[model samples]
Target: MGSREWSIEKRSDSFKAEVLETLSETGCLSVIVLGASGDLAKKKTFPALFNLYRQGFLPADEVHIFGYARTKISDEELRNRLHGYLIQEKNPSPQHSEDLSKFLQLIKYVSGSYDTEEGFKRLDKEISQHEILKNSSEGSSRRLFYLALPPSVYPPVCKMIRKCCMNKSDLGGWTRIVVEKPFGKDLESAENLSAQIGELFDEPQIYRIDHYLGKELVQNLLVLRFANRFFLPLWNRDNIDNVQIVFREDFGTEGRGGYFDEYGIIRDIIQNHLLQVLCLVAMEKPVSLKPEHIRDEKVKVLQSVLPIKDEEVVLGQYHGYRDDPTVPDLSNTPTFASVVLRIHNERWEGVPFILKAGKALNSRKAEIRVQFKDVPGDIFKSKKQGRNEFVIRLQPSEAMYMKLTVKQPGLEMSTVQSELDLSYRQRYQDVAIPEAYERLILDTIRGDQQHFVRRDELRAAWEIFTPLLHRIDNGEIKPIPYRPGSRGPAEADELQAKAGYVQTHGYIWIPPTL
Candidate 1:
């Protein structure tokens, strides 16, 4: 996915030059999963690699996978476990059994502690041998270490990788690391973590993975906004009323209660995922589509966000959250939160950017709703129907639709809500949309930073929410309890209305029938 997405002709000459340079190093690729014994490695890490292998992106002759952890499992044991996980997720048949067998043959497991050099030494030896066998004296080598482990171990694990697992060949060889997030509890901790990792690797070689940025619709945003001329004049403050970025879940923190309790919905979802989406939605057009240029624009948007007002925030906890043994009886952590961020920049100044996320809600979906201002001096009285809304649904059923007022089909001069929809599944039924991880992992191999988060970009994001997060942690603000299968606290809706979001009633955009 990265190789294809990066090669688009729209890329800046500078960007193309940089990518071409990286492409020149046709080294053997080695993907090492640090916490290979964990659920994330089995479910997402290995499965994405398998998909890439079967798709021919990772040529069997050029790529090898090493799974490292302290589980002490044999190579065959790990492969067997992967076979089960892939079968479970991909279902009865994703590919022919022969292809599955060959893909599994590429994996080898090693037991290791995150902080120790002894294990890393052995891992390095294995990787060096593989590279030596695959490449000639003139050829380079490429190594990617995926830290599927916890953030606490990042520093030591990264240190070990730098010390023992760096590429052995200096013939244009490179080493890259992919780290997952909850970058930290707040600004201070995040910076500390960044400093630790920064000492071991350069920023260009570090990939901060945000799965949301890899979503197909999210990636389509720049193309939708910049490539189309129709939206140029209407995308700013004067024409747009409000923007809502929302995430919902129909189930509680069933097994992740312990982890979810520490961060809450604000840190877990709103601060990172929704915030990243907001940057793309509200940012001014970049100087060019180069990775650095695009990320610079994102940083500007984050820095421009004004401090959040208490009146514009609502936090809620589901009634059954405390029932989980891992959750404290008096926990103030919010399972649901609606926050309104106002950008200080001219283009988005008065418009409210409302971000909402919740667990155990009535439905499951993530979407961006851009509500357009009502028509001025309207003779048709379409404002009575509802404001025009452009919605981009990110999951469950990926789609984009525009809600507008039109005359009722027959004759009576009345306005009705209608939509122009592009439902991906319905429109492109034969094209398989690759998983988010698939694209990002591939991007790591190709050294594309357009979709990944940057250091200062991350710092700016943490600054916006850290003050509010600290307040939540100190119990100055508490969560209002709501029923499990509900739309969260009533206060959330009131806050939305207060922030100028007009809910369109009696209008739902149904996906077109196949």
Candidate 2:
């Protein structure tokens, strides 16, 4: 089938109709962002909304933007704060300035407490006012409430939204909630959170957003795996040696350790982001690309993963982390962690999946490295040559490249490693790559759950890491110290070595920054 037809086939008839209507007509849509004064709102949420507006993806007159928080800020102040983050480059064009002014007019702010009914009632009144002003009484108005707040406030906020802010079902419009992750600290907590939200909304109405899943490279994993003939036979235990799903950041939290300390590197990055990538890399092909069908495969792969052993884990905290004014002096929170997972299924029984994530590391990168096993017998005496590797760099310049051995250019019979690269900047230079938050927010607007995590998938993911998390917390496992600029704890290298990963000595991938 052609690309357009295939895409239509993937979506439900109702969803296709909705998309068509949204594109062709001006519908009443209100996007209410809770915790608007926070960094996440300014840095990501508002910025994404503005981009959508600038691109004409959002209706000009029929849509409204509401920002709610406990802070007593006027709409002008909120817009000013959001303006700096809304795509104004060092040298913006006159059209960009015009677009910014137009986008700012759509946003309005409301001061409110998350737990109180009165505040939510006021919010509801504000939302309804827009509907009334647009003369949408006869037409339906969709409401999307984005919870940009912390997990601690999720229950009360969700309750408030359900009780006071939800749209009436009789009005023909629907209500959807977009939740950010660290879904819960553990499996039980996650289930409880899910149950609470489930009480208010159905499965279809809840979108568990993970920005990583919205990444262009991550979204491409399925297509790269299934559509490419080269990868089909090589993506198995017999051919693949080990997979390394790594996330590294060069910068430490500059006095912003409150949240990071509460949920260490494991809960912060590995559990949700890296594991989601793992599922995509290892999952069996779904029967179709339907949301539930794709999620079923992800759940299956997660279920097959055996509990990670303590011996296979390495935890590290960057030196001077406790010295951060915001971090407690006695904090044992891990700024870095590397753990090995062994899937017990037939296709991947012996292969080790190493998940590594860290803050204050050597460089900023998030990449999946799949190292294939070496040839049984080499004819050219190239045993020293590294095993083949298929790498998908998720961030810091998205790209995919395969490392393979080839004969050296000289008369010598020696081999050298070369890459068949597909750097995004080099290939799709003119195309704009949307931010993760942008794509995810757009998906939520379209009511597409394929990129969002399902409740079962969330639970299964937590199940894999919760025990290890508890052990680290209960046992107060002291993380080894590594300097802020270093790679990570020395033991992390040892852990990888023990897990059968062969690091190439001379080869390094320096991604092109465009």
Candidate 3:
């Protein structure tokens, strides 16, 4: 599925001016993308950086860029490759030629395995040549290392950087590292990874990225709750009957089946992105927006997740991923999973938190639905009809809508559902949502760790699903069958049905169509 969450809007003139001012004052710079040639770097990173550069987020003459990868290519070839990925090539902007040339001047490529001492030395040497580093302000130039590589490569790379690249004794500013998702296979692994990486970099220096947190609406969660009077009062279990977090994708493994089949939906999405969203939705208010304060609340939410029973969870695999010509026949990996997680905290006690996510399913949708407790002793006689619901759609529609029963206009006191809607498109006319990558990349440079995941939060998330992963791997559980273009395996529906939840009759279910 296409990324539908973030869109880039030029920062207001004052904000842009402030960013420029900050860069000039700090003399910080980005460096040697760990997995420069990987999909994320090519498709997301480069485009985002280029956008920032094009928009003057960074001072062209002062900023420096570097690429590190094993593959060796001439500077010309590398520049051409990056251009193809970063731009449409044809019908380029009048400013494109100058911008690309300026960017290329800042960009450098060094080929070597990040684990080796030689590799790290080469990277350090290459970075030292950059104007930004050479002109360092009486200290080591502030450095940002973006690790876009796989999980397996993270620790070794960090160790190498610490051993061979970091100049802690130097007067230069501090070093910050950016890491991608799928932090580890489970809780133990996540902790191990964290501890190992911590040995090299302080917790403050390491930024664990969860791009979902960068979305405007996702960020709006805190503001929507605390900034407004309406949401917080109804946020608890006493008022809210149930909460559903659905992250659905339309595409299967595609050609990445070989790699993705090894780690199903739970490990791939729920553990990091989806769980981060859940925490934001369920977390207790922090005393302040300080990074640690916010993160402490998130970890508490994660820790509060009640142990999931096998019977309470359901798993499903798209049929095509197992036997279709496009995917390996032996693959039994699940593309979808749905589970009910309860939080033992007083605020959410006895309320079910339904978490469901999948790929190659009916549609591409990311949404959270909060079903409120039925209006106290409803005056209406109809028994099946329940109370109102509040939904936040993160993708496709990018809107918030609430369903409340209202009296029918006619003489009969019949009730009908009415939606109080806030459509992003209609409400925010001509405004673009910043791309997640852009916001995240910008945050890294600004040293804002509030939106990123922390080691403890990561471990807490993994703890919740570790048992489920082991069960799936050891053949202790069989995936319920679900067809393409369908909601999911019948078990998913039964899951809600058992909890007395039926899909509301006349509401729209919009997933990301792209």
Candidate 4:
């Protein structure tokens, strides 16, 4: 992507440079990669760190990586395992070689269980050996804890770290914790979970990760709204008909059947990430880009979200998670969920915020579609153009396009629907889009809390969904099953129909073909 098209401004080089300076001066020693042996660690987390190191965001020296897990693996074995996933180019440049070597030297592994005091002690000892620990004390020390384990382990792990390790440290900088998704099973649990984590760490220190927020297109929401004058006046309930957020996948749990059964689609997607994005697109502009300020506005927008009715929400499950031969079937798991939500704020009372997510259905795509209300009293057959949508595609490709009514060329006074597309590939054709984990990991070290989720925001989100979770658990709601590779349950369509909305086009972009 062009410097302008990317999340951080090209002119913000000054800001980024300032952040790097702060990080270096902060005397942070080593990054603790919790659940280091998990799938997230291998596939997303560590790769992101490596990318940041290669990009010069991380210090070449004095920075250590401690891989903490209960896998009982040797450092050599761990490095080799990590190396398998690390794609290194042949004939690396001298600079890259030097940086990689320095990074490797700082890397080590510690085996420990999240539930044990002994485990936390071992992790503490490993961290203390690093020079960063020697360099800063009390408030100035910088330690970033990345939790890549299952959500069930989050509270205990966080509590242990806080009680056993964090309290013992006198760091001058910061202590930041990054946890992965499935924040809670429902609203009340989410609140309780947030409360548990919040008690252990200050709001500023907790980073509840939603990989989507780290995405290039996702972060660009602010720039798309505030930086440009074309969208603001038009971005209100008056002009917009509805907003749709779709997080779809074509694959099932892939042996993660147990976890899928517990969280399902709503808790997995809508409760945190997708709702955060919708708020960003709909929120009033913050006075500055300060982390809390941006997050505050987002929280307000979410709080303004009207509680949804049973009829407006649709839940579905794929063929039983346990029934699949690859893994035990975990039935009664709603792998798919769709909801038509309304934000009761002045700017968006009537607009429907439609959210749909499912696994093992249709295709893999994550996008936000903003449908505009038709022009009133238009002479042209305006219903055709009434389907105008501003789509932000996140997966398979990162791009933005706006569907509008245009006069057909050489035609009998007719208007055709077409998109004003700005494909990221076509723009900056060669720049590699970094992974979410990489961007977020770098952000943690650099002290840019803008992209990470804060504790209050997490609590507010939970408050919005707690009732739905309770209803589902009480069997007041039943999941409507959809066939594999289909768009989702029939109820999903009915939910949209009730709101007078429809997907106007056949699948415009398909990932399998790509």
TM-score of every prediction relative to native: 0.95, 0.94, 0.92, 0.90
Clashing pairs in 1: none
- The weakest ten consecutive residues by lDDT in model 4 span 505-514
In candidate 3, what are the lDDT values of residues 362-401, reduced to their tens digit? 7787988888876667668533555588889988769888
lDDT of 4 by residue, 411-508 (tens): 57887777777787766555577787887777777667888777677777777788887788677898877788888888788788788675664335
lDDT values, one for every candidate: 0.90, 0.88, 0.80, 0.78
Per residue, candidate 2 scores C-alpha lDDT tens digits across 129-228 of 9988887763378889999999889989999998998776546677889999889999899999999989988999999999999999999999999999
Clashing pairs in 3: 7-433, 7-434, 7-435, 139-171, 139-172, 140-171, 140-172, 364-511, 364-512
User: 3-117 in candidate 1: lDDT tens per residue?
Assistant: 5444543353465456445644577788999899899999999999988777667777888899999999899999988887776344455455767889899998889888889
Candidate 1 backbone clash number: 0
Arrange candidates by TM-score, highest first: which order? Answer: 1, 2, 3, 4
Instruction: Show where candidate 4 strays beyond 4 Å.
Output: 1-16, 88-102, 132-140, 167-171, 320-322, 325-330, 505-514
Span of 10 residues, lowest total lDDT, candidate 3: 1-10
| Steric clashes per prediction | 0, 0, 9, 23
Query: Which candidate tops lDDT?
Result: 1
Candidate 4 global CA lDDT score? 0.78
